[model samples]
Target chain A: MEEWLRGLRGMILESLARHGLPFPVGRDVCTGWAEGLGLARGGRRILYTSCMYQLYPYVKSVTGLLESLGVHRGGLRARMAARGGSLARFLARPSGRDVERSKAILRSIVSLLRRGGVEVGYLYEEEPYSGALLYELGLEDDFARHAGMVVEALAGRGVEEVVTVDPHTHHVLTRVYPNYVEVPFKVRSWLELAKPTHANRRVKVAVHDSCLYARFLGMYHAYRGLLDAVGIERVEDPYVTGKDTSMCCGGPIEAVAPDLSRSVAELRLRRLSALSRTIVVVCPICLANLSRAAVDVEVLDLAEVLG
Target chain B: MSWAEAFQRASENAIPRTGMVLEAYRYVVSWARELRKVKEEVIRDLDRYVEEAMSSLRAVGAKPYLARGAEEAREIVGDIVGKGKLVVMSKSMTAAEVGLRQHLEGLGNEVWETDLGELLIQLAGDQPSHIIAPALHMTREDVARLLRERLGADVPDDADHATLASVAARFLRDKFLRADVGITGANALAADSGALVVVENEGNARLTMTLPRVHIAIVGMEKIVPTFQHAVMQAAVQAAYAGLFPPTYMSITAGPSSTSDIERKRVSPAQGPGELHVVLLDNGRSRAARDKELWEALLCVRCGRCAFHCPTYMAAGPRFGAAPYAGPVGVMWAAVTRGVEGAGNASLLCLHSGGCREVCPMDIDIPRIIQRVKSRYVGRLLRTG
Candidate 1:
């Protein structure tokens, strides 16, 4: 497990330094996708960024690396958590395919912001990883150093304000970064930015707030405000759905213990399953973990179902 | 073994109980803020409060004993109660720390846990999974099975909660009457009037503290409040946090039962215990007092609400708790009193949801405390693993 994590960490760090990309995002997938926006190098006034913005392909790269180490999808946690080896589960960890879906989510949010009359610019290939995983893993030194590097990269690109795609990135850049490093950029989750001008979608979705967004960031209301304006029908489950009462998606423990992560996710999924057939989420981490756990239900990103 | 099964059962019980507590918080304006202020003041001057409590209780003809640690605490209790005396005790985390029941039983004294949950777990030979609701891990069927084996009773496999309680009560009522000594844990120790205030929904604590010829109330030194009014307020907040409406029974036991009704003569022995012994156990609390960051942990009223709301605890039950203490608060208590290793991997399971901290009446910042415990392990092991 240690060797696997170490190798994964090295791969991510190497990709960030060499490619000038925070995540191991797919080069081919992002190339044509980047053409419409026509991303420029200098974005001084407003820069819409995300720590895990390139999450879909980055997750894919992680899965590929793990497979190379003889740990395939579904088999990843089994080999590591093979005590009784009775339980079987889907791999909810971020993968390259998840990065593709994440890209779509980001694209919709960017488009929504554009329609909201905000001229948002992207710092393509310049944005660095926010070291959220490092902080969560209790690697304070690495996190502090990585935070400084990320801040430096953003500052070097002359970016002042950051509109984040997901709460994990939003939380890290805004809250965690200032704790250790000097963060000069103004930050907000894109949900906090995008105006709900589009007509009602008329869809019923059960919203699951990831721990960071709901509790720490206090952005649960922001999502609700958007959903309400978008005219989506919200099916509230008093048992499992609410502001602080909602359960965690268990994505954070994926690095430490995948089986435990699966257990946590499964527990949360059961509560959510009773609520709605379609579960909508704001955080990419939540989308990945809950989507994998939703065997009998469909999980949608907030962006996927929104304006 | 089944995290989902336990999570479902525990949450089903916890959700409504939590609502009651939240409503209490809502009605009692600034409950958390006011309590935090009072608790902070009391905990900072814990030594003075401890001294004041001892001096005042002593004046009331109750002998107050101080023990440095768990070993000393057990020895002190043993000395007072003596050998071959029936001892009936309520659920007290302080007593559990030193394995008091086992120590007394080793010396040939019969010790019975009077609290229903504690009694069930005791019969089953199990440690408490939750501090407030100790037998939370055991289902009704499990309790029935344990009772049948332990007490040779006609307990059916599918006995209802009322039936189970009746059996436990019938068994404990005799012990309460026959016992020579009654022991309890105080929620708060008021220094001004030297009152040991313990609040409980079950009548067991009241029975355990009052019925016997001798009463020994054991509490951590951190339980002390400044005055009677402060004790009253503390009880209110503690009850609200514990999902009770200021508790069904609030036992404010100042000293041995006294009577001045006979021509103002101040005769000591009344209906209650003739002799009273208040054991204020330090047991690493002073060390916690000196530490700046860890000091607020001592302010915990042990309401057990934090555990109920905690996801890891809900899923895993006892697996999420430290020994002698359960849930997020338990993690802190076990770390401070016992050490970091006892907290073990359970502290790491905390997802930093901040749910526990939000509902915490004292507002102890439990997730951060868990992080601190995790850091200690990380520092020692040189890895997050």
Candidate 2:
């Protein structure tokens, strides 16, 4: 799990850097995701949502899993098979409908296990679509029906629990859906779910509390605790805090109020000067914002905190 | 008003030959660029972190309320202040952002600003020029004369910070004890448990919130966080950003001061307020939230670190921008929260160092946001041409 998390962090960092974002400390990223996912227990079967770019490094692991499944496929085929049945075909087809169908398949798998009395631990759902599919479709009355379909499918497959890493999904499942109320839900970040065991030496760290974390979400301290445990002695930068009091970090607002973005960044840098010379950020867009700042401090993802 | 009209008005009203307007813009851009370089990875993990934060806030038993505009915020504040008197308030830029204090005072409540900086500004009959350091532009001589003029002879000439502080403390102590109501701003609000976090160096905020019979906390709707743990981290980030090792004090308020220690009943402490009312103000934030470029400005945690790090701000000596928010963020905030007319010209001075971004906990791309706003100003110039 740690290895996969490291790889994932590296992939994200590389992508962000390519886009001119700040670099992140690996361990901070790992701990944040670990805590978010509630995976600190040390024993759990964690399944990752895969894209070809993300699953590339796990080729050997996928190949082994596929071989165990009696499939002699190599490379890409093996990787696809390991994700589950029919995922490869969907990926190859590449259409909006295909994306929808793929989500349905995953949901079906979750429901099937729940029904089979398998006592599934958690389901990490992503964004835009979850149990709130009915709401999105403007069929609010069918919410119960759609929710039941998901629940029964997970239960039928012997999966007893479901969790979502996306707050929007969690909000819909826990707050919006009726059938989902019975299911124990833990909504968190991928970093919180994958805590790193190693710590970085002589490193300065800065944490960017995502707007959702500071304004909408409220898991600010958990992210801090995770960074502290990873041997990151300093955490700086505070312009984002509380519920609605936090700054937007120039994501959706990039198209309109670009000057406000600079102002927000300037505000954040003033806060960071007190913590450490290096910044260890937890969020991706923050990294992007900091990267454009072009300061002297070293910026790293939380995942890079550990060896 | 349109960004162009506001910019023109502000530029025209600005103190000539200061160059603060252009310098502020350059500094913000430079600071933002520096922050971007350091927090690259965090930008990628933004979506995940936001999810975690929102979930935690909900778990703590807080309700999410969206405000569409300034009118909505006024309504929320109106509900909380209904027929109240002898109100004592701690300094909060959020209140200033929506002009809550003036609005309340206009309603005839006799509001007293308890923070020394705020009080000094009130005495001087001027608006706050900075967020944290409200009277940053004033010198000891200026304060001494002002105090002497208002409070009379006993006030010393050459009064130092400590002496001035004591004088302010002595004057406000009675008000703290006698005030019927208290108003304050939150550093962070945990949504999961409904915890309001306030960080301060002075004990005034503590006294203000606890001493009054009815305590009112006016926070922006975006101040919500998911949990206490996240609030702690965010506070640390705020302190660091502001160049403080740790904020001198931290207060986590869940609700009204209550104790179940009494016999078969709850008893409130003598010092703590009995009733707590929270007023969540939206005031231009919903539009900011939806605005791709400007929304990032809403993520500011109010640490005031950006102003401290800004070279132009330091050189300009605090008269750099409009009241309540006086740095790079202040310039932009003035444009968005206030009309662009009076304070928006400060953005023209920013140098775009990206240093401010390096220290931001949320890593908002301040320079880019500033550029976007400026581009609009430029666009207006062309439209008129």
Candidate 3:
């Protein structure tokens, strides 16, 4: 492990343990998207954001801050930033514009689910971070403990089935959580539960397959099926969207190596822009990372396009 | 080239390769499963397999030597070749592992890597970016320049790939004829029959192993299989997943070549090399097999397909892993051969997207194992800190 990664790990673990989120952001940033959506407080089945989509904008901002600070180079400065050297101020808030953009995507997801005739409850501020980052960083012990906390929070709220919005949260809840913690709730992606009616408009978009959805959670067909059902024509290219060949959005390493992450995103974006000007993404991280690198292309969430 | 340019070129090269792999993937997947089982069984009792293989090699009249470390392996080959010998070598990760070429050269022997890509990298004095395609990072222009400068071959400024290949081929053909010794790596070693199987797309391996009077093979212990039939299956499975099914050539050598046609009686030292030496290089492989989290990595057949599909590998070129091992699987192999700390930074390049495991023929849980490697590295760091 590098010095900065160790420092960042310590900071993130402390934040998650203390505040139940990876950052020091407030509850409003998490539940604000559901403010006027008329979603119920809790139910047997619920829409679980896991705050990934909401938290990502903040993650994007902080990573940019870290990159600008040359934290990727790693040294005493990294340890100082980890100890809250103007970092807390950056992590304290995401830009209102970015927040609104993320909120609109979350809104689009809720609208799509509603149009699909699925009424679901939202946990709002009670929703816990999925600890997917912990799992990704090889912090299994911390992730296991965090998974227990997340499971307990959902179970206590009578949440029987989790309707996940993003692939990372979906995969962690469905495939990874069971290995670490005893889970009483059934987990499913909103893509599986939402049965949206056919769209009247025709559109062409390049669909970017999320690595987790395509390779791990097996939602490649489901998302493509949804696109087809909505009368959207996906510009297919093996190098861009092939199940085995599609590139990652580089979000996985954004925090540790933002420059490399941007490079990967640019590579993926180049493949996508060659096919279509409008790019559709299934994962929030993909949406964020690719959107950063996209110059002329419009990166939209699958829900934003479907709805 | 810049990382972006390198990444784009790699993607351009790998895209079609993956397409071809997908075409044969469904058919070869079952063979991959059985191959993994065979590898697991062999590694489980690797010591017994080593002894059995050595005995079988002796029975077949091939000298067998076990090297406990890289230094020992290099010294064993060095002593055999002596000084002032001309050597032709096929592309072998094991040979790279033990630094055999450098060591042999240090002993005052002339060595040439016969594979076109390996040769280009050797001329450039650069490490291999991808195992199968050593010079994947280099452009045709780059090769033309290297060949023109290093070999003084006649290559046009805008020479095509075929032109470039033929020029190198013509140059190496002379070296092959005059070579005093040939060194190669075995894809799989059959303990039952003492057969060494080498799979390749070019006929260079055949020439490198057969044209010389002394033939020496260096193989990692994890490459051992139970029988000759199993060894052939292993080669086929490796080639199939690498998107080259029905490989161009698979040479299965049980021992030194001999003729009995002279007097209806067995005769030694015939058309091929009169002597064959098999060096079984351990070099941390046996210890890796005993590691609970990492042993599955030994199941890798060195197909290099994972690098094709790995995002970081494609993006960073040789930067993603230790030399001679690249991509997701490379980090684990680096951990096995170079220790966990050596693999620490490289392992971090992995995105844990599960792409490598998804495409792996042996179905090795690459991400899980890398995480384990990462966790161990982190643990060691924290303890020391």
The lDDT leader among the candidates is 3
Q: What TM-score, over all chains together, does every model reach?
A: 0.89, 0.47, 0.95
Between prediction 2 and prediction 3, which has the larger DockQ? 3
Arrange candidates by lDDT, descending: 3, 1, 2
Q: Give the TM-score of candidate 3.
A: 0.95
lDDT of 2 by residue, B112-161 (tens): 88888888888888877566767766767788888889866366777787
* lDDT tens digits, residue span B223-254, model 1: 88877877777777777766677579998888
After superposition, candidate 3 runs with Cα above 4 Å error: A198-202, B1-30
- For A215-247, candidate 1 gives per-residue lDDT tens digits of 777776888888888688888865577665786
lDDT of candidates 1 onward, in order: 0.73, 0.51, 0.84
Residue runs of model 2 more than 4 Å from their true location after superposition: A1-307, B1-67, B82-84, B262-271, B315-322, B335-344
Full ranking by TM-score: 3, 1, 2
- Candidate 3 lDDT tens digits, B1-385: 6656765676576657656765756756677778888888988999999999999999988999999999999989999999999999999989998899989988898999999999988899889887787887788888889999999988877899999999999999999999999999999999999999999988999999999999999999998999898898888888876777678999989899988897877767888999999999998899998989888888989887777777887677677888778778779889889889878888777787777886788888898888888777766776677
TM-score of chain B of 2: 0.78
Return whichever of 1 and 3 wins on DockQ.
3
Cα lDDT for residue B242, candidate 3: 72
C-alpha root-mean-square deviation, candidate 2: 21.2
